[model samples]
Target: MKNLKLAAAIAAAVSCGPALAQTEIVWWHAHGGQLGETVNSIAEQFNASQSEIVLTPVFKGGYEDTLTATIAAFRAGEQPNIVQVFDAGAATIIGAQGAVIPAEDLMTQAGVEFDANNYISGVRYFYADSEGKMVGMPFNSSTPILYYNIAALEKAGVEPPKTWEEFESIAPAIVDAGYIPLAQSHSPWIWTENFHSRHNLPFASNNNGFDGSDGTKILVNNDAIKMHFSKVKEWLDKGWYAYYGAGWGDNQTPFENSEVAMWLGSSGSFGGLLNSVDFEFSATYLPYWEAITSEPTQTFIGGAALFALTGHSDEENKATAEFFKFLSSTDVQKFWHKETGYVPITTAAYEAAKAEGYYDEKPQAEIGIKQLSLPSGDNSKGYRMGFYVQIRDVMNREYGRIFAGETDVESAFNVIEEEGNKLLDRFSKTN
Candidate 1:
């Protein structure tokens, strides 16, 4: 009887061998709703492709919340194997010594081939360290662009503007046609930081914190930015532009409902707008201040990347690298790009889409890629400022006062520089 029982136990163990050997890698991310569903689908596909690794994705609120939670968990020695961090937090994570395994190191240590050059330079620059090593896996990258309601433009008898001057000139007509001429999210990323990059204007010293955080100071209150905001203040005073307060989504409704003719939004907004909006629309490069420069330079990318946290075992790191490899595959990149409207992270993925006539069918998707592919200068490489989340908050507060007419544009910008420098100083001291 004992021999028979041992034989049955052996058989049962043999049948469940693969299941027992599978490694589970927990990934905490900020994607929710439809995006959350897509993340799960990717994980499912990866799991199905291999019996040795299983990805468990957990939604942990928005980007800021996810970052905060990850930090707290790390201090408690209970962090997930992977976490998605937004561009704003890239510098913070990169400066976090011993908190993360740089993506390049992680892949190499796990025997997975990773070439930093495989990523789009514009997208990769944000997550790379001083040695050009990628600190995180580029996942969803996007640039700011102008989205206009097609029907609204027709009704207003005006075409989309190419320059800030043209936009101001056409604003009255758009307003006369019973639609708000312009609306933009109060997020400083769109209005200030990216605005600076698009025009090749420096937002800070030390090469925008790329060289080092030491001695880095805010340079945003210069003449170029001042001139830009002055125009914005004029538009606000004339009721040509609508301010919908701060953050990402507050300004989207007016554009979606067609009450606003044009809005500045992330390139990723394309996918969501396609599914939700009732009206036809098109996107173009964001308007530049032609007076500031002869033409606009490349825009900086804004999106999150996956970072592998420390304290995970070698097996978990191997699993994480495998998942990252799957993510960078052309097929998966194309799917993610199509589903999220994020720019494809690699040239191969972009070429795949181009070869399939995907761009012809969805031209809006190509605008961001074109903008990011444009000639880049020092200022356009990307911001690597520390504590940028807090810097953005300061920009929001001061810029709000300017929009509300509580303070002049110059005064608000000055306050931004002063307050921003204080924050930078704090970061420098700590880091």
Candidate 2:
């Protein structure tokens, strides 16, 4: 009887003993709606792939909002294990000093195999520090591309323009065909910043703040920039370009209804557009000025990256590294690239897409990749200025003043330079 009771007690203890506790890692992100669903699916898959970690993806509003929340959370010692920060916020997060773990260190310390060179040059350097150390994991990268309605272009008897001059020549016909020739929301990242980078013009001093951010100055008053603005103002005046104010989605409805023939939008919009549009459409590289250069320079990236925060337990950090490793896998990357229109982050993912003939079936999807694959120039490296998001806001406000006839192009840019320099100075002081 004693032996029987002892065996029963042992069996009970074994059954009740705590099962392995999963290290739950919360990931705050800005992806919402369909993209949010996709993000959740990724988390689910990663959780199923391992029993040691449970990734919980939380929707934390838009990019700016998410960054703000992360900063607040960090101050309170309640930051999530991981946060998705937009490209513009890269410098701000990096300059925060000990706010987050460097991705290279995170992977190395966790014993995960990490190769920073696996990321493409166009994207790899954008998130790297002064000494070329990657501070964040590149994810959901995109370049600005021009999307055009094929039927509208055909009815207008013109091909999509490859050059700014060609676009000017074809604008009248597109307008006469009873369609808005072009329209874009107030995205200076596409119009001013990337334009400068693509033409090898300096948007700011100190190699666009890549060398150092201490004394960077705004430099948007060049003749090339002025000429482009002059043409845009002319187009707006002639009713060839429609102005929809300063919000991101204000012009999307017009384009989707086929009322607008062409618009400058993110390459990330391709997947959503495939489901939203009834009209046949295609996308191509952002039009460039032939006079500015012999060929178009490599365009910079816009989109967010995954950054690991500090103050997490070692096990939690290891789980974050595991998630990052999963994200870097070729299969995962290919799935992400196909599900979203963003460029694949790794060369292996791109090769997988090519071998599967995915790009052939949807050639428009590959345009952004081809553009980013082009050789990077000295000026086209990428923007790394402090408070870049605020700088973009300054640029957009000046653009509104120019379009509303409140200010001339040169004067508006001068205002941008003065106002933007103040913001940069403030950021430099804080860092």
Tell me how far the alpha carbon of residue 134 in candidate 2 is from the true structure, in angstroms, after superposition.
1.4
Candidate 2 residue-wise lDDT, 123-142, digit = tens: 88788777778888988899
> Given candidate 1, what's the lDDT at residue 384?
81
Q: Estimate, for each residue in 366-403, the C-alpha lDDT of model 1 and write its tens digit.
A: 99998888888778877888888888888898888888
> lDDT, candidate 2, residue 401?
86
